[model samples]
Structures are given as C-alpha cells and as structure tokens.
Target chain A: MSALLTDDSIVDLHPLHIGTEEDGAVEVGRADTGMFVALPPEGVALLRLLADHLPMAEVRRRFGDSYGEPPDLDDFVAGLHECGFIRAVDGVPWPEGDDERGATEADPAASPAGGTTMRGIALLGGLGPERLRWLLSRPLLLVFAGVWLAVPALMLADPSLAPRPSDALLYHRVLPNALLVAVIAWTLVMLHEFAHALAARARGCTGRFSVGRRLVFLVGQTELSDVRTIARRQRYAPYLAGMTWDLIVVLGCLCCELAAVGGQLPRTVTYTVALTFIYQFSVFMRTDIYYVIVNALRLGDLMGDTRRLLANAVRGLRHSEPAYDLSGVPEREMRIIRWYCVYYLLGSSTVIAGSLLLSVPALVRMLRIAADGMASGPAAAGFWDGAGFVALVAFQFGTLGYVGFRDHRRTRAGTAATAV
Target chain B: MKIQIRKLERIETTVACACGS
Candidate 1:
C-alpha cells in the first residue's frame, strides 16, 4: 500500500467523503467542480462496508473470496484519484476538523485545459419556433441585412462609380486587397458559427456564446456542449460549415461577375470573394484546416499538450523537478502528445515559410503602389495619397491594439481577483 | 377541527418524526 502511495505521489491531494445507506450501498457525492458520481453496484457495496481507517489488505480480504481474484483496491483507488473522487493522504496535509470533503476553487487555472466561463453571453434556451420567428423579425437586424444587400446592388448598377476618398485611402493605399479579404473572411466566420448554433439548437442543446481568442486570434462563437459528447460527424460540421458557406458565396460572386453587363462590380465582387476564400484556406495558422487535422487525429487539447511538451522539454534540459508536471497525465495520452509535438515542430516551420514566401511579393507590390501614389500626389485630386494611407494604417493598428489590450487587462484582472 | 373556506379548498397534511418519541 505504501509502495503504491510512493509510486503515485499525489501532492495537494484532496480526498472526498462517501455516505452509506441502510441498503448497504455507498453514494459518492462529488463536491469539487460540481461533478457527481455514478459507481457500479460492486464498487458501491465495497465502499459501504470498508472501514475508512483500516489498511488496504483488510479491505481486500473482506471481498477477495466472493469476487474471485479480488479486484485490486489499489487500482480502484488510482482510478478514483484520476477521476478526482479521492486523494492520497500521505505527504499531503488536511485541515484539522474539515470532514465534509469537497474541492475548493483555490486555483482558477485548475479547470480542464481550455476551460473557460462564458461571459457577456446567454444560451438560446429551447426557444419555440414561434419565438424564433419573432426574434428574427426584429426591425434592426432585418434593416441591417437589407441595407447590406441593397447598397452593394445600387453601387453595382450605378456607372458613375468613382472610388470614394475614404475607400481609396483605406482599401487601395493602406491595406491593398487584404482588407476586402478580411471583411469577407469575417462574414464567413460569423456564418460558420451561426450554423453551429443552429445545429445545436436543432439538437435541443443550448450553446454559450463568447467573443474571445482561440489561441492568439480573436473569434466569436458559441460552444454548445462538451466536445467529448458530440459525435465525430457533428463536430466536423461547425468547423467546416463556414468554409462551405464561403465556397457558396464565392460561386455566387463568380456568377455575378460572369453575368454582369460590363461594370466594375464584376471585378470588385470577384476579387473580394476570391481573396476571402484564399485567406480562409491559409491553414498554417489556427484555421478550419488546423481544426480538421487536430480532430481527425482525435487529439483532444492539442494546444495544452503542445504547451506541456515545451515546458517539459525545457525542464528536462535544466534537470529540475520538471516545473511542468507530467504525473497527472495518463501514459497513453502522453505518448500521443509526444507525436503531436514532433508533428507541430515540423508543420509550423513549413507554414511560416509558406506565409513568408506568399506575403513578400504581395507586400512588395503594395509598397510599390503606395510609393507611386505618393510621388504622383497632385493638389487637384485631394490629399489622399500618403496622409490617407497613414490614417488608415493607424486606424487598423489602433483598433487591433485596443482589442489586444482589453483581453490582456481582462485576464490580468481575473488573475488578480483569484489571488485575492 | 378546521375552518372551511368559501371556495372549495383542498387541505394538505405533513408528517414529522421526533427521535425521542
């Protein structure tokens, strides 16, 4: 028993208490993380009869005859430990009188990897069809969508369309075609998430919506249920649905371009749609393709695993008590993560190289265009060359910085409150 | 004995146990 304890060195272990009934069955009330227990009959009876104060051998002897070779109680305890039902007592201190065992929220980071509380969002809980119709009929949303479609249509029809000063400054000089790509990408992203929410609702499950960072990039989405509970096909839908919509939009744009009776709309719309689709397919970054690869390999928490591997490698090099603890993880998962690390190491380099190669030419062209615009700035054509370019760049950068700062401040505030 | 209401009412009773008893 001591040997088992020694091998499974559980530090800061928090043990739970089980209650027994007159029927001689035990019910484990999980107090930590608000998780409940669902134990088998044999395990329940064993827990009911066993003495909390006695050694393992005594408990084993009581059940060994009937259960044949007697299921290893040590193994049972280890399973319980893994499930967070019990904790090792040795080398860990407990409060003097606290017997009602439960987990405390002392560590804010203690939730499962990538676990987060959804803030500023609510679930669309079980809304009836009638209610949904009413919600959709809201005047503001309908107006906005109608306006989005109408303005573009009107612009396409009008032949006297000169690039507005703002448009020229923002799109042409500052951002080139990339800003159009971003706008289109954003639409697709939103539509993709909408599909997930719709599917989740159809399945009678409510989803929690949040606008936050998925790794480094900011995204907005609703996480329906635990990914573990979702079917493989169902999980694949939300990730790919947006891309599906993007393809559809691109096709629509192409149709418009091919059918249009000689106008700027054809080129503008086609270029916008194409750029959006290409931007989305840029998979080296955490995009649809990244998720597809991660999910296909059944690698849950790949990001967390990558972080742990990096930390462990650093620790091993220094020869310290690996500040990154691998003891809590199962050996099988750890082996899988090792493979993932090797994959990431090779894959990330290729992605970076590809991005650099693709971006450099585009960037050079943009710079050349900007330079030419600066040189040919005439007083008759309004001051939209260098000055306008600077303002647009400043605006984009300022907005991006604000978003990053807000996230940083929020995380810091949460950490500070947890510390208190 | 209980007082009757003007409107038809259903009366409910609860049982309590004492350990000393």
Candidate 2:
C-alpha cells in the first residue's frame, strides 16, 4: 500500500517469465526466485508498457486511451513492488522482504532447501532422476489402470477380501500389530511421495518430500511448487502420481491376500493401504486428488479464496462492510467454491468429531488394558505390552501437537517479519 | 472512471499441496 514513488520515479522492471494462461490470467514472475503472480490480460499489457520504462504519466495516459479509464498509477506500481514483482524502484532495487509467502517456501529456517528437509534422499539411492522418470511414462498408463481396476473386480468376486478396519488388527499384542502395519504404511507413504517427485523430475522440475500435518492426521506431503510452471496437461501425473503408487501397492496387497500366505500381514497391509487411499479422496483436506481438481479446473488458490469469500460474507453481516473485495471472484469459480464449502465443512467436521468421539472409547479401552497390566507389575507377561501401546499413543499425539505448533509458529513469524 | 487491477494470487506458495498416508 506504499505510495512513495512520484511521477518521475524511474522504475527498472525485472526480467519476467511468462507462464501459461490459467483461465483469464497469465502466470508471470521472476524465474530465479520462482515467485509468480497472476495478472489479467489488461494488467499484462500494462506491465508490458512499464517494462519499456515509460514515463509514469505516459503509462497512465496510454492505458486510459485503451481501457477508457486510467488506473491509479502510484498505487498499482507500489503494489507490484510490495509483491516483489518489481526489480527496482527509482533506480534502487526494491527490498525483497515483502513477499512473506516466498519466504515461507524458500527460507531455509522455515523450509529446508526450498520445501524439503530430506533433500535428494527421495530420489532413490543417489541415482539420477532420469532413472525413475519412466515410472510416470504415458505407456505405463494402461498397466496402472489395470492394477487399480483389479481391486474392485476382485472385491466383487469375493466380498470378504475388501479392506476393513478389523483387518488391521493382526496380533494379540498391540505393539507387534502396530509396528508391522506402521512400518508398511510409512514405507508406502514415502514411495507415494517419491512417485510425485519422480513425476515432477520427468518434466524437468525438482521438488522435495517432507513430513507435515494436515488437520488431525500427520501426513507425508510433496512440495511440487515447480509443477505450476509446466503445461496443465503435464501437471496431472505429478499431482496424481502418489495415488497411482497407492493403487499399485493395494493391488500387490490384494494378490498377496489371495495367496493365503503371510498369515495376517497381507490383510493388515490391505487395511492400512486402503484406509489411506480412501482418505485421499477426501478432497477437502487438499489430498492428491484435490490438486488435480484444482489444476484441471484452473481454480487458483481455491481454498484461500473460499475462506476469504466466507469471511467477507460474515463481516458484511456483522458490520455492514466486507473484509475482502467481492468483485474479483469470477462467478463460475464462486459457484464451485460454494459447493466446495459444503464439502469442506462436512469433511473437516467428520475428522474433528472422529478425533473427539472415537478416540474416547479407544483411549478408554487402552487405559483399562494398561491399568490391568500395571497392577500385575513389570515382570508380568502383558505388563509391558499395555505400557508400550500407551506409549505409542502418547508418541503419536505428542508428535502431532509438536509439529503443528512448529509449523504454526514458523508461519506466524514469517508473516510478522514481512509486516515490518 | 476507474480501472481495476486484480491481485488474486500474489505468489503461489503451495505448502503441502499433495498429502497421502
């Protein structure tokens, strides 16, 4: 919102990289930093005029002649500077700290090496990305489709083979059952993320895998920010790659289950994989499928936009004033968001309610079991078993809280720093 | 008359865009 520049302000515009046209706006930004902004066609035309280093008044006059109205030159230019879209203002490089979003992504303190704490490890054995790129090749599409379709076909033939919650409980001891399934689940999670990384690498984009929280669940996420630079058609594999990997894993588990070997291991694997796979369909949590929906629909910042639209509605009700502008949201996007809002509430509520209600009975049962084991002393057969399960529960919730706090605090610090 | 410059997306910082497991 700063308007420090005058009519004579000599702005040296940065070299811009123009990206694909999404809906009506073109994605444009500095390639070096990977910071991009969506600008209307008219806005891009104005930017072209500014890049020519036109005089401030002349720039405004030209835009007025074309559009029938002149924009507020000072405010518009200042806004660009605030977004780090301007290289320099008045012959001095604009200080880049205004872009808090960029800081959150690229800041080493917030995200290690551009959104990855474990850099290059996800690429498999220090091998080149080319080695894994073929996993996402178009020719393999038929294989993947067959593998995914096998599950429903098999399930229909034998109803007992469908993945269920009971299948996850494989052993009498809680620790053994939890450990075996957790190991497999986490392994598949990493591979699921690797699929996304490999898909992006195929298209000459490099992203990293990291552990992050999504609502109540501790999730494994891939930071495929670079995918935005690619064509929309090429973007799908990267976005849907994780789900593709999950389907393969599920197919393997089903085949193993039908083999009748591995005792209960295959069933546990099926349960764990199936539950997580179904969770991805919960698009409200921004799962793998959500990105495809967003990309395919060209719904840029759908969640954030909907939240603001909702806030504006509430604010208008309370104070007869809106917090955000309503004019910018295209009616089509607004309609989609309206349906998204209903789904968001239902999905989010289900997670929260399940966390509260279902956990109570589960925790109570665990506590009772722990109490019985503790009364028998340390040397008893089941004493440490209950203790171990309780500890596992504690560890899961503890890590969830700790990571959530760390992420929240880091974002708040970035915003606060940028505000100054 | 006034012109509008929409600031729909300042920067696309997709934190945890795709999550699984």
Candidate 3:
C-alpha cells in the first residue's frame, strides 16, 4: 500500500525545507510532492517510467501498450507541476515542451529581475512598515522640532553642554547613567527589528533572527524576507522603519533632556540622553542616513553597475573603448548615478585625509594621557585605561577608513570594468 | 473597431512587471 495524496496537498507543500545540523550548519532539502508521490503498488513504477527522458507521446504509448489503458497524461503533468518536480519553461504552454531535469535549473523564480524584487522586498521587511511610513511622512520635521526646543533650552540652562574635552573628561556627570542609556538604545534597536519582523509576517513571509556587526556598529536583525511579489510602493515603508524609530528615539531623548532642564531634574540625566542622541546621529559611518540616501536615489542596482563601470574603466585604460556595453541604463539615471559615484568617491577621500590630519593630535593626546596616568600611579592608569582609550580611537578612525576604502575600491572596479 | 484593435495590441505587448529582462 502507498500513501494517499492530493493535488492540494502537493500545491501546499513548501518548495524547500532547511534542516539544522548538530554542528550548527543548515541543509536545504527538496520535497518530492504531487506526481512523484508514493502511490499504490504499480503506480509508483508507472510514475518512474514516465520520469525517464523519453518523449511524452512515447511514455504515454508505452504505458498504454503495457497496461492496456494510458494514465491521464495531462493530470500526471499537472500533478508534477504542483509537486514542483517539473515546471514550464519560457512560460510556454503545457504538454509538448521539454522538462528541464534539474531542480535549481527549473526554478520558477530564477531570473535576476525576480531575485532583485525578492531582495528589495526583504530589505523593506527589515525596515518595518509603520515606522517606515512615519519616516516617509515627515521624520525631519519631528527631528527639527526636537532639536529646536532642546538645543536652545539646554544651551540656556547649561552653558557648558558643548562637545568639548572638559565634557568628555567629566564622564561621571552624564547619566541616567551608562547602563540606563545602554538599556534604552538596546530596547529601541529591538523595537526596530520587531517592526521589520511584523511587517514581513504581515506580508505572509517568514525570516530568521541574527546578531552581527552592521558595518562597524553591532545590530540584531531578522533574516531577509521574500518580497518578490510585494509592490514597490508597499515596500518603501519597511525600508525606512528603523530610521524612523531612531528619529523618534532621538526626539524623545531631546524632550527628556528638555524636561530635566526645565523641571530642575538631575543634570546628568539630561546630558547623557542628549549625548547619546548626538552620538547616534553623528555620520562618521553608515547608519540611518545611508538607508535614506540609498533608497531616495534608488541605488540598490548600482552594485552591479559599479562593478561594470570599474571594469570598463580598467578596459579603457588598456585600450581606447570599453569592452562592455552600458547602453541599457536610462541616460538620465545613469548620468545621476555616475555623478553620485564621483561625489561619494571624492567626499570619502576628503573625509579620510581630514580625519588623519585631525586624528594625529587626538591620538597623541590619548597616548600622552595614558602615559601620564601610568607614571602617576596604578590608580591613575588602571588596567584597561590605555587599552580602552586606544581601542576607542582606533574604532573611530577605523570606521571612516573602512568606508573610504570600500567606496574607492568600488569606484576603481567600476571605472576599470566599464572604462568610466 | 480601432479602440478594440489598440486594446488587443496592448494585451499582446504589455509585459508583466515581474517579467523584466
């Protein structure tokens, strides 16, 4: 006896399943449903016979010749389609078309265009819809209001609330305290991830959770959700979600700082929150600002273009004309993207050079401070004092350096690829 | 008749958004 199955059963079966390994690896498995399903005694044999590389007519004839009556060929093929054992190629009509044997090769969603759609959707899911909608609607307005109220109020109340070495040295003065700030930032980032997950789930998609370094900053994120079928406009919200929340958090922090100042609360509470907000906004590296610019300009497609441009540039250096063609891109968009590449390329270089020029003094100062502390006493230069200071300095300069290097490499590659 | 022909031509030529080459 064979297991019973139906067309609906085959249709409902997931295209793929990922299994976990004992050693923390993932293995993807293909489910053989529909026509390939186990059936009563001779039926499995019959299906297997048809699965051979013989033509449809020949298979049907052979089945009929052996079994007296032929199985319904259309139904069998439809079952195969539902099971995903086979699929139509070129959107060609049913029956006589060739069935490409490999599972990966016959994928219904194989095109690069479809992959881009999926990636776009997944990025939006990561952004979260409600928060993203808020950003798109008017995040800058809220940010401005908070800045206007807080900056003036705080400055008036505390004349010394500036980004100076005195403030940096007076670390004990800033609070709700470091722990409280940590808790708040962590909560906000988690909320950002939740917004993404909820949006993805709403779209009938699923994803996995992960924690890793998003550029230089550590971030917790959900896996990219399948967005192939999602509409473009519907997607913009999810992409902007995290940044939206970040804006709100910044505003809330500013408001708290304002309250603390106006109501005569602890000075440390006001300063700490304000500083955190500023630190979040400081564009020394890619953050919310990166997403805003990337989406606004629709430069997701530029990764390939950058490579092509670099290749062309390299080719042009070798020969007169580019070996590869770049005529497919729209003239206006291409012009704008190229200009963006040039500006970003130039801007990053300036930042690195400027940073190096400025950082030497800071680095020397930090080293000198560490040296002085060590000379004075063990209490003055504690175990982690120098290491921590050095690490922080490295992190600050390293971030800018990394971005500069990546941008330059892309430009060089693009220029070389397309002789840009 | 002209409008019907135009519609037919569009039906034949109009590509699905997902079908980008």
Output the number of the TM-score-best candidate: 2
For all predictions, the C-alpha RMSD in Å is 17.6, 5.4, 16.4
Candidate 2: fraction of native contacts reproduced = 0.12
In candidate 1, residue A288 scores what lDDT? Answer: 54
Candidate 1, A163-242: lDDT as tens digits: 23232122443443444434544555566556555544544334445443322234544544332233444455445544
Candidate 2's DockQ? 0.19
Write down the TM-score of model 1's second chain. 0.18
Q: Candidate 2: global Cα-lDDT? A: 0.65
Residue-level lDDT of model 2, residues A320-347, one tens digit each, is 6776665766777889988887887788
Residue pairs with clashing backbones, model 1: none
Top candidate by lDDT: 2
Q: What's the C-alpha lDDT at position A80 in model 2?
A: 71
Which structure is stronger by TM-score: 2 or 3? Answer: 2
Error of 2 at A276 (Å): 1.1
Clashing residue pairs in candidate 2 (N, C-alpha, C atoms within 3 angstroms):
none
TM-score of the first chain alone, every candidate: 0.52, 0.84, 0.46
Instruction: Kindly report which residue stretches of model 1 are placed more than 4 angstroms away from their true locations once superposed.
Output: A1-185, A206-229, A260-286, A327-332, A347-392, A406-420, B1-21
